[model samples]
Structures are given as structure tokens and as C-alpha cells.
Target: MKKRFVSMLCIIAFLFVSICGRIAYIVFSNDFTVSESYNSYVLNLETLYPVIYYYNLEKLTDNRDKYAAVLRPNERTLTDLHNLFPSSQINEITNELKAGYPLVKYVDESKIGNEKYIKTFRMSDYECVQSQLISKASSGLLSYVEPCGKREMRFHIDALGRMLRGDEGEEFEESLSNIKGIRLTLDKKVEEIAYSALSDMQNGCVVIMDVKTSSILTCISKPDKSYLNKAFSQYNVGSVFKIIVAACALENDIEFYYNCSGKTTVGDTEFSCQKNHNHGFENLSDALSNSCNCYFVNLAQKLGSKKLLATADKLGFNDDIKLYDEWSFKTANLPNKEELSSKGELSLFGFGQGKLTVSPLQMCYSLCTIGNMGVKNQVRLVYSSLDENANEDIVKYKASTRVLSEETSKELLNMLRNVVENGTGKSAEDSYHKSSGKTATAQTGRYILGTEILNTWFAGVYPSENPEYAIVVMKENGKSGNEDCAPIYREIVEKLNYL
Candidate 1:
């Protein structure tokens, strides 16, 4: 009896401790959720971009593929002689047409004498709207080879699922009602152009978009059909993100002038410029053009975390972009004020380090707003979904929010132009057209023998005065943005000039 009483007492004490720990956790955590592990943010292996599609429609020609085959595979062969005669008492009728017993019979009207069935074959004979579905039932928008099947009546979808021809066949209403094509914002010509350039790349993505509209013209993820779109996948963006920090600085009217001794320390955390050498004294535009780390870090510390976060929020960071429940191009993470309590952390955040991660798409969009004279259009992937009839049921999705002011836009545009003219991103310049851009070589922390792995990046806008396009290129583990990514950007710019 004494032992039993002791056991009961211990159980009661254990329950009390558990309840107290839960309360303490809730109180101190302040209901802020620590984000999920890094791997959880990735899309699934088999997940295809459901919104990937093209806008234009071409009419499919009435030409049918001609072929020749002796008979359908299901029909009994001539070797099955027992079932040859339909009226034979010794055997039963086979499911398929008996081979030996020809169905040909004398008829009053004969074009090629007596014939049982047509001799030549055409794909149209075996193909119907239902059979056309046999090929594309598995893949959504990923396949470039397997074409969408024909509706038989008149309309036939092309290989890429773009509606080539539309005219309701005899069953136009029924066929149209059955067909649903998800329209994507991808331009066929632009996609082709981007592909031809990046085709040989082992891995990476090439993204181009309409700066004014924020509509992606081409988004081709490399490794051809990778489940994760590296173009939109978030990574430490390095100094390419300086544009955002710079914008924030300008918006807050922070002093753009500072002296750089090449290295500075914040609470024992030393930060150095790229070359570990002094840049002397410089203004904001010079710092941006030179890609000075010390200048930005000092600016970030002075601005404080609250103001920086506000700037990031205004520019769209640490936000949810609900593209799908399990799949999406999510916004990148930003440091909270509490985490920025230390000068080191704030400085790191200022220079695009310390847990900062962002998709190329997000960066492109931010630059688009700068190019769009501070107007930010919602990133649109799809124009609308349509049924076969071509009837009007357009799902219009478009909205614009001013992301920056016109004055800031003008100043920033000029600063970007300076970058191409006399900055780390000089390769982005062109002889004929004005260009503006930023280059970055982000440290990945995973080093070997004291050498660092990197994520190189380049973000640019062409025809700077009145920008038409936003272009971005990235290379994983590529050492320098200028050496690796900038040349690729130049090639793309030259190609665009041809157009």
C-alpha cells in the first residue's frame, strides 16, 4: 500500500511539469512560428507546373496522317482457320473478323469492283476525341513532344496543348463542353529563344518577363524537366538584392555618403568588401556601382531593422503567394526586428546574407517595379482557362500596386545605368541600347579547402529610360556573377536586339 501511494504521487508531479512547460513555451514564443525545414519548401518530384501554357491558337490543318496496315491487331489471323466460315457448324464465331472468309460480296454499285472494307488507312479512321486523350492523360503541361489529341469534329489541339484549330465539328457543343485547356502566359517565340541559348546548360534557369506587366514571357527551368523550377526556387541572392536595400535607403532618405576602409566591424563581427581593400569615400550611386559591402552594412545598421523590414515588406518579402496548397513560388524570408538585435545580424541581412533566401521570380518582379516607374503588377502566369466552344468565359486576373515612387524610379534607373557603364555588372551594357543591372556572387558557406561555393546572379532591365523587359540569369556554384552570369546576360541582350 505504501509503494502504490508513492507511484501515484510521482505520476501527478509529471503531469504538472508537462502542463507548466507548455504554458511557458507559449508565453515566450509570442506565437511566432519558426518556419519549416529547408527541404519542406521544395515542390514534389512529379509535380508539373499546372499553370504552364501558351496563349496563341493556330488552326490545325484538315490533313490526316495516312498509313497502311493489313488489319486491326485484335482480329483473328488467317491461321485461325476453324473460325473462318461464319455459318460453319463445327466452330463458333470469333470476336474479331475471321481472316479467310472475305466479307466482299457483289453489289450493284462498285467503285473498285466488289470490296468488303477500305484497303488504305488514315489516322482519322482510328482517332477520335476520346482516343486523342490517350496520349496526354498522364502529363499536364510538362511534355513538349506528346501533342494534345484531336476532337475529330474540327478542332485539334497541337503537341504543346495549344489549340491549333477551333471549329465545332458535328458535335461541336458536346466536344467543346468536354475540352478544358489551361492557358499560360508563356510566349512561344520567347520560350524558343531562351531555350536555344540555355539548352546546353547542365542546370539552371533563364527567366524573361514583361517589365511593365510582370507577365513572364519565358521561364525555362534547366535539366529540361526538373520538378523544382530553379528559376523560381529561393536561394541566397547575394548582392543582387542590394537594389532592394538601396531602394529602402532612398525611400527613408538615409545619407548615401560613407567612407569605406574596405573592412568594418559590428559588435566583433567583421565585414569586408569583396576585395578586402578600401574603396575610399563614395556616395550611394558609387557604392552601388562598385558593389561596396561596408557602405551598405553601415547604412543597414543606421536604418535599424524595423525600417529595413518595412522596406522589404513594401517590396514584397516574407509574404505568402498562395499559388497552390502544395506547390507555389513562395516569397523569400526576411529577418525580423528581434533577430536583428545584434549589429552583426543586421549587417549580414543588409548585404543579402544570414538566412536570406529568394526566388529569381521575386527578384525579377522587384526589378520590374523599378523599371515600371514604381508600378508593380501582380505576377500573372495564366490568362484564363477555356472550353472547346471558344465561348466567352474569360477569367481576368490583373491588379497593380505602386511599389515605388517615380522620383525614386528615375534616380535608381540612372544608378543602374552607372552599374553597366562603370560597375561590377559592366558586361550588361550594350553599344546601341541603354541598359541597367546588378551582379552578385553569394557565398554558400559550404566550402572545401577554404574555397567557397557560390550562387552567381545577374538581374537587368534594357532600354533603361523606358524598359521593356526584365532578364535574370543564375548559376549554382558558379564563382562570380560578372565572370559567369554576365556574359550569358549579354548574349541574351544581343539576341533580343536582333528582334
Candidate 2:
């Protein structure tokens, strides 16, 4: 009997310990309960969009200054930034959230009675904005917070008691380039600006047109001091001038198979490759691809300055081509007869490193000329005249004139295409699109007494079988054209691929 009693006592002890452990668990679980409450509040907060529901204490019907906080609105404004929301007025938007306001049918606020406030919202505009934001956010293009130069197009206003437009007065003034219809309003927001010709660059513009129909696509420039259509005013063409050297060589009957012994001594001066290492023996195609100064200088000695100057002038280097707006670009200080007589300087001109100055737009024109198989077009920045009705009237059908033999143009193009595929410009390969181009690293700034820094470049045309577009990219003080400019060109081409 005593043994049976002891066994029962042991069972009773186990039961007591289990109950105490259950109590301890309940006591330690305060964090879990608080977390659940916080998550539930967050879920409720996300549903508010077009309409914000908050406190409305007026309906308490109690004879007290503050009637016990019972008549609270379901929502309140989270931020006072009116520049982020362009569509809503504070009072009108939040009115439905007031106590005793009629609830919309699409949204369910039935959980809270008429006396209590429940936030709910639905709007087509809000849906559209949300969809666009979500789509762009995943692509790493949109940000929840504004980055520098990227301002929110919408906002919320607290001081005005309504949603107000963000003040864009300073930006509109500063952003004024070759842009049209940009006017500052009394309210400080930009009233309107034609989007076609707007440019962020300090001075930049583009004039694109369809040749057959003479349909103008875009004419844009900014900083009103400059015009889009003129090519007489000088800008650094940088290494883009290499296209001229390539043309001069072929025009002078330089064979693509001819070889350069890498280094050539002219008088007492020695001109060598940027690598300083010898290319040993390379053909004309490789010389052009590798941008060999010795090979081009040797060839330029044969072509002489007269032929090179004539070729550049014929290709529209000397003349000013006007784009839309008042902008103009022109070639700078061409080598004279005396300078061209020196073998070293003449060779430098062939490689586009010394004394040969042109504009970025001009270089683009030369590339287009080559792509058009020696037909140089009268470069048009604006293809039509804008009427009073804002309709574009066709004014010009710029036809291309023969600049070089078609065979010569094709030969040079094949050599450039091969460069992109196998030589110095191999990095410029567009996996998303097929392109043909060449890289150039022209010395622009003096690094030491004799040596100079390079301005890298990559110029090309796309869809090689039947070309449609040509582009040039230049990076100042870059180490190599293949390294710096080619990647930028690749990105620009990829962006243009879908368009």
C-alpha cells in the first residue's frame, strides 16, 4: 500500500511541473503577440490609395471639448510632400473618410460601422500609376526615393489644404536648351515644353529625318546660345576624324593588303603606335583597324596634303551644316601647305591625331557618307517647316551626292567591320545587334612635354547587311577607344535596338 502511494505522488509531481512550464511559455510569448499586432496594422495601412480615412471627432454628440477619441478616422496623411501627388485635393479626397460619409460599393468598408471609420480606396488613375511604378521598379530604373536630377512628378500638399503641383520654375529655366514651348508660369511650374528638342547636355542637339519622304523625326538642342542646324561653330570631333584618314587612304589607291613595318622614322622624329610595341607586319586593313600612325603617315606621304584636304572638304568638313535651332559647327584650323610638307605631321594627319579638327556631327556625317556607299548627303537637321497649326510641312528631300567610288567605300566598310569583329574594336560587339565600327585613341591633351593624353572613340553603323543608322561615341581623357567608348556605344545601340 505504501509503494502504491509513492507512485501516485511521483505522477502528481510530473503534472505540476508540466503546468508551470505552460505558464512560463505564455509569459515569454509577449513579443510574438506584439509582432502579430504590428503586421496586422501594416497590412491595413497598405490598402489606402486614392482615399485617406482619418479621425472625424465632430459626430460624438457629447457635451465635451474632447469626446473620448471614439470618433477617429480610419486613416491619416503619412507625409506632407505635395510634390509627389498631382491628382488629389486633401479635403475632397479625404471627405469620404469622414464619419457618416457614404461608402463606395467597389471597396469593402463594411467591417467598420457608419459610426466608426474604415479606410478604402479605388481609382483608375491610381491603378495606372501603380502599374507603371511597379513595372519600372523591377527593372532597376525607378526608385522609391528621388535620385539627383530625377524629381518626383507628383506630390502631396499640407499648407495649401490640397494636392498642388511641384514647383519646377528653376529647373525649367536651367533645362532650357534648344527646346521649344518651354515657358515659366506664374505658379512656378513649367506650363509646357515640346519634348522632341529637349537636351540635358550643356549644348547638344539632334536632327533626324527620313530621306525618301523627308519626314523629320527629332530636332533638339538646349542652352539657347547654340543652334541645332549650323556646323560652322567648332566643337572637338576628337578621334572621330579617323574616318577621314580611312577615306583618304582608299581614295589615294592604298591597297588593303599593303603592310606597315610598325615604326617609321621621318627626318629626326619617330612616330610609333600608342602601344609602343611593334605590330611587326600588318596589312592596310589591320593598319586602319589598329589605327597605325606609321602606316597612315606613309600612305599620306603618297596621297599628300592636297588630296587629303580636298577629300575632307568634299565630305562636308569645311562647310557649316545647319541643324534646327541657331546652332552651327565647323572644322578647326586645317593644316596648311607648309605643315603638310613635313613627313611626321602628314602621317599624324592620316591617323587623325594632330592638327585635324572636326565636330562630332561632322564625323557622323562622314560615317553616314561611307555607309551610303560614297554618297554624301546634304546633312539636314530639320526636314520640314512648322506651320501655325503646328503641322510639319515637308521642305526638303536631301539627296546624297557621290563623294567616292562605291567600290572604295565598300572596301573601307569591310575593313571597319572586320575591326569590330576581330581587331581593336572587338569589345564594341553588340550581342543584341550586329554592328560595324572602328576604335580610335587620339592624343588630345598634353600629359608630359612631348607625350599627350588620348580621347577615345568608337564610330559605327548597324544592321551591317543593309545599314540604317550610324553613331559615334567619344570619351575625353579615356585610355583606349576600345575600352571606354565602345561599351558606351554598345549601351546606346542596345537602347536603340527596340526603337
Return the top candidate by TM-score. 1
In model 2, which runs have C-alpha deviations exceeding 4 angstroms? Answer: 1-240, 256-261, 324-327, 397-399, 447-452
- lDDT against the true structure, each candidate: 0.65, 0.50
Candidate 2 residue-wise lDDT, 331-374, digit = tens: 45577778988777787787776677655455666777777788
User: What is candidate 1's CA lDDT for residue 352?
Assistant: 89
Regions of model 1 farther than 4 Å from truth? 1-53, 58-179, 322-329, 448-450
> What's the distance in Å from true for residue 286, model 1?
0.5
- Candidate 1 per-residue lDDT over residues 47-130, each given as its tens digit: 111222366642112123433222221223223332222345213333343432222111122122222332222232222111
* CA displacement after TM-score superposition, residue 7 of candidate 2 (Å): 99
